[model samples]
Target: MTKMNHKILLGAAITLASLQQASAVPFAPSDARSMGMGGTGVSSAEVASTVQFNPALLATTREDDHFGLKIPQFSLSVADDGGFIDEAEDFDEESELDTTGQGRTNVDLLSDLLDEATGPLGLEKMQQGIEELKAAQLLPNSAPIAKKTAYDNAATKLTQASEFLDTRLYSRNPSVNGEAGLVVYSGAIADDMDDLNNKALRINGGLNVAGAVPSKKFSMAVHAGAQVTFSGKVKIDPKDTDILRNYSAATSAYLLNIDALQLALTNLDENDSSTFDAVDTAQQAVDNFNYGGAGRPESEGNTAIFVDGELSPEAEDADLDSEIQMIGVAVADVGVTASRVFNIKGHDIAFGITPKLQKISIFDYTQELDSEEEFDSEDFSENQEDYSAFNIDLGAAYQFGAEKQWQAGLVIKNLIGDDYESAEYISSNGVGGAVVSISPMMRAGISHRTSWTKVAFDLDITENDPVAFEDPTQYAAIGGELNVWRIVQLRAGYRANLAGSDQDIMTAGIGISPGPVHLDIGVMANTSDIENEAGIALEFGVEF
Candidate 1:
């Protein structure tokens, strides 16, 4: 196929541009405080973030808190353990330059050689001269000395041509293979395509605003937020690999046929009574030289030179069947939480519930990797599906210890599970359908708290399915916060994926509270392979 510049950001930006509503679908904690503490807010959340963590926190938090407000809490994360981004960037970089240490890009070299081989003064003319020599009539009993001279001339020229091919095309120069860029030989393009197959890039982000009024007797909170998630993957067609690989093989085969004909003419016996028969034998070798059996093997079918003894343009013009499939989900939710504490068996227990309305939009866009099609805002919107639904969250927390410093909590979000179908997009199989399911998410946590120090741990009891085409996640996390005289707080934690499909992360954050206004910043990175995963969150709020 024709070479085209592949700047992968065209696909990346489409997913990132929808960050306004990419949340809640992953159903993971996104607030700065929670994220800093390794997504462990189930039991340790303060009244300010009770709506996002555990609503029961509204009643279970420190008795000194009365009111809390959080406006514009934001967080974003990306994972690319497959090295898809790196590969794309490298390919783009290589495509921009010319004449590396290898003399020229492999494709350019092959293309130019192909043009010359099929030119007016190339292999075809040489072959015609041989045919004319074969067709010359021999006089009765005359020695075919003139015919032998012509044959020798053709053979000598063919030997020179064969040596040129060997030096320029066949010989692997030390510098050529040492270069970093691709050497588009027989299987190089196919190997590159295989490397990209199934590699995925995922991005998720959310923005939220919330307010809460806390009390042991009764508590209430209101939260409105939006989150967006995008996932993109490479889908390669096997036919694309075969076509490209076969084209490269054909070029080599074309050169091989020239050598075969040269050898046949060199061994011909022109002075024999069967001189015509010997010339006929060499002519047959040239005409029937299909150039198979080695390198590519005879069992793999014909790898002959293309149309009418020339490299065919169809090989370069054919459409690549491979495509980059992208899916994005934007969800917005508005919810209200109510919580209360009750004295049961001489101990205080808190319970909370939230009923929420959700608006979800799904975008499914698929395009061939080599396509020149452009996508704009309207095009993206056209590929989206929107839906509205209602959901509920239930939470409970209990405190038991000498001074009630030990607390345990449980939360079940999206109590009534539902599935939303995505907008139709042409799939690789020619069908058009996908489903995003919102299932009940159950998590349990425990925390031990003292005036200035707190440690908490949480575990997801249920695995959350991917909203698009990513791995399902179930996280178990441990985190702690140190409050320095209530002015500045330092937090750190580690989160591990119980499902074992994603990277484990280490998180840290700083929260500065001057008087009642607070600012929180949290950052996280994959414990291993740092470049593959990272996230950051920021939130500003006030609490009393």
Candidate 2:
């Protein structure tokens, strides 16, 4: 695992350094009202939040809503359907290694086995015993019991060492899989590697403040807010799987040599010259046993333990090129909005415009697998690229019906599109960077209103491109609101992806407005997987 993966898994609640989504759908930064109604606000937004959806709504608001002040509003969303985040968080807890004493890992086990097999009391000691037996053969007067004892000791040590290798490195247990029923594999480290293959995670957050004055003749508002996103994915090297899985096969070959040498020892005969030649052959085999040299593996049994002499591929410090890529962005904007209602042939039409200044900061970071260094959130800010630009938004709304209860609205945001490049990183493969794209997006909405009930629907007319690394999105949403004598309100809605890239979302919310002061809260989650996809918004304000 990389340091960035750890930082995101452990410090997610305390830091905003990393977040990700499976799809690149754009998120709205409006108040709880729009969120509760399935993000449908273009045609039915209140005066204080009209600038966030369709500015024309500022002038077309209810006749009694003379003034609106939304001091603070906040929203957050996250998606991780891949289960990457959960796997990372549970890595330590779910590890199969022993935790009672030294907490030995697979690398530690291999190192111990290698040292025992090649150390002073290992092959060298066995060779010394063989030399003693050869001396016994040379001296015809030597006691047969002593010679036999020497042979037994040498053979016993070889047998014990072979058994040790089997227990420690070649053991297996039963396991069941959905696709492949009951089967046995090398087990621990290889299984863990398979679980971590290719997975992604995402997170988003926003905050805003605004104030507006509503009027049919002329309406005005000021809005300011910021939206931040963090996301990443893991990319495992294919070589790691081969290295971990082939250990059993290599060790089995070594065990076979041990068995053959033992048979030659058991058939030893001092009187038979042919037997002498067999013993010599077995001794030669035992003495010439060799384990392959390490660096990068060239074949089976040649797992790369050390890379460039200092770092081990199995250790946390080894750099095996890029294994994970992450991106973070913050977009802040302040805007002044103006709108007016016009009357033509007994019909009411509203038009509005907003001009805003935007500051965008983006961070692109990458890290190799098995890295131990801690990832700092400040790195995102320190290495980010900053860009400043001016943008415009236009909106229009028309009201009709016998009691003027029907309304239709259209909004075009970010008329002047711009693209900014983020920081870059170089690896053995190539250079990589993130592009923060601002593009024009249009949405159309329609609504029907009564004294106590209002229903609205909205549809995206253009597909919006991702700002970082996500999928393009177009949405169709429907929502309804119920007012309880202007005191309490309940809202429910649903949103569907027209592009068929993401899951459908269900939304619900509540509002309290006894007099001039109001408080609202809204929440949303995908219909299928609530744990990986969810959102919440909250706001406090005054309206009349």
Candidate 3:
């Protein structure tokens, strides 16, 4: 157990501990009422919830007048399976170490240490060398000549170290010596590293407003809503870039320009260059850490650049912004819906249609981050593409049971089955472009009701393909709600993904209708092995 390796491990552990929270793809209801009943309302919605769940149900409402406004909502759903927090939790502190207690470390440890000048490897290596030289001066019984040589060499090393400490490479351009510098000892993302690195993030939010005119035979409503979905990963990839290349050369120049290290690196062996040597280039070298004459290759007059003075692979690469990929989509919908109730064969049936206009915007982006800061939002939107289109939604509900308390509802959304192309960007080098497909989904549901309690079930007949790399979803759910004198209601339900990728989602909600002002809140928990998750929702609206 050498004291040195222990310090290295401690430093590495601390560096690896810096992690950003992760976001993953999640499913949440658009409105609070549906959120409460297992994200269900296809056949069981009344009040203003009818606009979103099933427009046909608007004609069957028991309330005299209808209007709704939900100002804001926040839903934090957990999906840590591929998130940064999960990997940080499972990091193996001793995985890179050998059991023999040898003084060896992964040479690539320099990459992380290089990211910070004060890191263990660089500072410790320098200090260790100084200490070893000092110890040599204390040898006993040595020749006076040998002792004098040891003392002289040690004094010279200390002097040069002091000079380098005062150099501009360290004083002014601290970033390269800071977080921007890293020479990857490991190759591209490997399997072991992939496991340690994989993690994503997803955030979603929405707002809505609606009002309805109700009658026994016919009803009409106008619903407007806007939603946004943001998804990205917390992992950074190593790539070559023009910016880093210059930085690498600059760092190399400074390390080489230091008199102490230059004495060794620039010294010529028997076969030295015809003319150039440390003494020749020493005066011309700037303390910028880039001694290679504007970072040109060695053949281009950077003969003074070798050993410690040349550019590192980490410094030569560019575009720290290209490390992470993010995708965002915003959709605003305005729909005018109308429904009519019919009596056919002693049955009460209603049919509704909604013609809506949608403005779609998508930002498909990839950036190489130079530092840990965020991407510029204004710059991101500037490169986005948006479009507007019209669509139709058709719905039908039939009442049939011993007491007509049972209802069956069917909804066909985006009946046109349209395709949308989100914003697409390709670099001049043809290396970066992400094309995503925006598609459609259709669903249906049924529910039975009584004076105080109602039970419902819903299913998505079509697979809802995700735009990003997320999984497609096709699920079925069963839920129920109990009303106490139409004052406060308790609701619970469960849903399963028929697509085979999700868990049995358990849901519960509480609603307080207190007359015209209505408030409903719901929660959903993923109980199966599919990435551990839980979600919450809230909505408050007024109806006449």
Q: How many collisions per candidate?
A: 7, 8, 24
Q: For residues 1-544, could you state the per-residue lDDT of candidate 2 as single tens digits? A: 1111122222221121122322232647657988899989889888788988998989988889999988788889887656666655544343344444665544343444445544545444544555664564454434545655566666676666555544544433313312110011234444544555555566778898999998889999999998887766665566555444554454454456667777876886645557656766776664454332354246644544322311133422223432656677788899999999988777789999999999987777665554555677786676677889999889999988888899999999888887666656322222366666777889999999998999999999998655443455688999999999978999999998877555689999999998999999999998888976789999999998
Candidate 3 lDDT by residue in tens digits, 90-187: 33232343234544343234333344443333433444435544464355433545544553465355445533432312333455444221222222
lDDT of 1 by residue, 382-462 (tens): 778899999999999999999999999999988988877666633323255456667789999999989899999999998
After TM-score superposition, what is the CA distance of residue 17 in candidate 3 from its true location, in Å? 21
| Reference-based TM-score, model 3 | 0.64
TM-score between candidate 1 and the true structure: 0.79
The Cα local distance difference test for each model comes to 0.71, 0.68, 0.56
Better of 1 and 2 by TM-score: 1
Q: Model 3: runs farther than 4 Å from truth?
A: 1-29, 63-78, 88-112, 115-193, 196-198, 234-322, 343-346, 371-374, 426-438, 500-502, 528-531
TM-score of each: 0.79, 0.76, 0.64
After superposing candidate 1 on the true structure, give the runs of residues whose Cα lies further than 4 Å from its correct spot: 1-24, 95-189, 242-246, 262-318, 374-378, 425-433, 468-470
